[model samples]
Structure formats: C-alpha cells, structure tokens
Target: MKKIDAHAHLGYIGGWANVKMDVDELISLMDTYEIETTMICVLDNEVAYKAMQKYTGRIEGCVYVNPLEPDCLDLIDKYVKLGFKAIKLQPLRHAYCADSEIVDPILDKAEEYGIPVCIHSGHPPYSLPWQIGLLAERHPNCKVLMIHMGHGHGVYIDAALKMARRYPNIYLEMSGMPMHTKIKEAYDTVGHDRIMFGTDTPFHHPTVEMQKVLMCGVDEQGLEDIFYNNAKKFFDV
Candidate 1:
C-alpha cells in the first residue's frame, strides 16, 4: 500500500541534542523508508521554502509561522500562494496557548485559505489540549491537527480525545510519543479514520510508527486508512 507521512520536521532543533537534521539527509531517509509523500515544514521559513522548492514533487510543504513574527499573516499568504498545503505552529516553543489572542489572526487566515494547521501539543512549554480545543471552537472552519496528542500523557490525551469527539474540525496526528494503547483507545473512541499517521521523522522511524498501528490489531482496511487513505482524504492527496 502507498504511504503518506502526514507530519515531519526538517530543521534544526536548537539545544535539543537528540533532534537534529538537515534537508538532504531527511530526503534520503524518506527515500529509504519508501515514503511516497511527506508534509514538510521547518522552523525557519526561508529554509522551509527552499527545501519545499527543492523537493517539490515528493514533499507537500507546510509553512511554519512564528506567532511572534511581525507581519506573519503576509508571510502566510505568500507561502499559501506558493502552494503550501498547510500552516505549522509551535505553541510550546513560544510558550503560548493555541487560543491566545496573538494566534487569532493566523487562525483566521487559515480558515480564509481553506487549509489546515498543525500544532505541537505535548509536554512542557507547549499548549495543552483544552487550549487547542478552545481554538478549534473559536475557529470552527479551520482544520486543526494536534501533533503527538498532547505528548501522550494521561491528562492531555484525555483532553485531546474529548476535543476530537466534540469538534469535527480537529484531528490527532500520531508521532514522536509512544502511545500504542492510547492510540487504540482513541480509535475505539473516535473511530480509526480520525487518526493520521506521522513519524515526526528524524525523531521516530516512519516504518516503526506504521508498525505500532499494525500491531494494534486493527483490520487491514483500518490499517490502510491510517497509513495512507485518511491522509489522502484529509489533504486531498
């Protein structure tokens, strides 16, 4: 079956000794893993744009927007015009919540453009699930994909699942965190189709992430949906 990695990071993670990668090496890994397509984004906009341009066919680019950046909406507009499939936000890195007033304009723009937004939603310094839920409530038209399911902790996962159950616009992307049981629980609660497969590559292995879902004992059709079909439908791939 064909595969599409719905989330991945391609830029340097400063100070985090474990997570570091350059674009060339990432592309090599994608090729090695037989990933037919990836949703690529970088912490740096210029680098992301260049990498997107470089791997135009193989990667569906998502532009990163720093909520603190001045004239951020203009940059988002420019990239969306450049054919980026979505916008990426790191609320935890910035110590901001998803529903913060600062991000309202960004959410508005995403709704206006009819594209999705991916947010890092786990652990310290990141916004919690309630914040993400509030943002989704405020912007019902915008599609929000929660990265890591709030990092798989008990409280965050519970909040995330509650939000996904309440809002049609919210989705949970599986990556980085080891949450096989929680993922299965989410599937049982929200249905298998609501979850999307992601590697958070360079941190987790794509094939291994896929293996987690397989080992969950979901049927072949459920596996196909998570591995590729759901992302295809989500991004119109």
Candidate 2:
C-alpha cells in the first residue's frame, strides 16, 4: 500500500537549529523509504510552493501559519487558494498558548475552508492535547489533527488518547511518539480510521516512524488506514 506522511517539513528552522532539510533532501529520503506522499510545510511559503509545484502529486503542501502574524488569515487564504490542502499551526514556535485567542481566528478560517488543522501537540503551555481539545470543542465543523500524539511522553500520551477518544473531530498523528503500546492503545481506542502516519521528518526518520507502527502488530486493513487511506480521505489528497 502507498504511504502518506501526515506531518513533515522542509527547510531549516533557525530557532530549533536541529531542523534543516531542503526539498531535494526530503525527496531523496522519501524515495529511499517509498513514501508516495507527504503533508509538508516550510518556514518560507515561496520555497514550499515551488517545491510543491516541482514535486506535484508527491507532496501535499500545508499552509504553515503563525497566529501571531497580523495577516495570518490572509496568508492562509493565499496558500489555500494556491493549493495547500491543510493548515499547520505551530503555537509552541510562535510563543503563544494553544488555547489563546491568537489561535481562534486560525481555527475559524479552518472551519471556513473546510480543511484539517494540524496543531503541534505533546508539549506544554502551548501544545497540549487538552488545549487542542478546546479548539475541537469550539470548532465542531473543523477537523483537528493532533501532531505528535502528545510527544510520546507518559502523561501526555494518555492525554492525547483521552482527547482523541472524546472528540470525534480529533485525529491522532503518530510522529515523534515512540511507544508501541501507546500506538496500539490509540488504534484500539480511536479506531484505525482516526489514526494517521507522520514522521515530522528531519526530526524523526520516516522509516523509523513507519517501523514503530508496523511493530505494533496492526493488521493489513489497519496498516492501510494508518499509512494512506485515512490521510488521503482526510486531506482529500
């Protein structure tokens, strides 16, 4: 079955310093691992757009918007019109709380566009599962993709699962999450349809991330759902 990376990024993040992967490098990695598609974002929209244009059908562009920007919603509109299928909100990097007013307009725009909003989860203050849950509760029409599934930590993993179990709109993304038991718990509790594969590439290897899911002992249908079907249906890619 074809695999779709639900979360990925290209280009260096100056703040993190550890994150730095150009489109060429990413494509090489994807090719090595046989990843047919990836939902990716970048620090520079133009670069991302160009890469998307260059690698059309293999990369699904996500409009990575900082809620702190004055024209954030406008930027989102521009990218969406340009063919971005989803919205990526990184509250932690922007130094804003996930539940703050800063993200409300972004969530509103997501509802208007009828696209999935992939939020950075599993951290503190800004990217917790409950905080994302608040957005889901408020925006019932929008689909919320929880990136990291709470960062593979103990408490947050349970929190992520609890939120996914409680909110029908919430989808669990397995990236940066290391526990096989937790992955299995997410599958058993949220059902295979609510789970999607991601690597958060450059931070985690796509093959390693795939191995985490495969080792969970997921059946063929479940593998299909987690690897490609759910994401293809979620983003309409």
Clashes of each: 4, 0
Cα-based lDDT for every prediction: 0.81, 0.87
Worst 10 residues of 2 by lDDT: 11-20
Model 1, residue 1: distance off in Å is 3.1
- Lowest summed lDDT window (length 10), candidate 1: 11-20
Query: What's the C-alpha lDDT at position 170 in model 2?
Result: 95
RMSD of each: 1.7, 1.2
The residue pairs found clashing in candidate 1 are 92-125, 92-126, 121-150, 122-150
lDDT score of residue 224 within candidate 2? 85
Off by over 4 Å in 1: 124-126
User: Which candidate tops lDDT?
Assistant: 2
lDDT per residue as tens, model 2, 6-76:
99988776665667888888889888877898889886778879999999988888898888889889999
Error of 1 at 225 (Å): 0.9
Superposition error at 111 for model 1 (Å) = 0.9
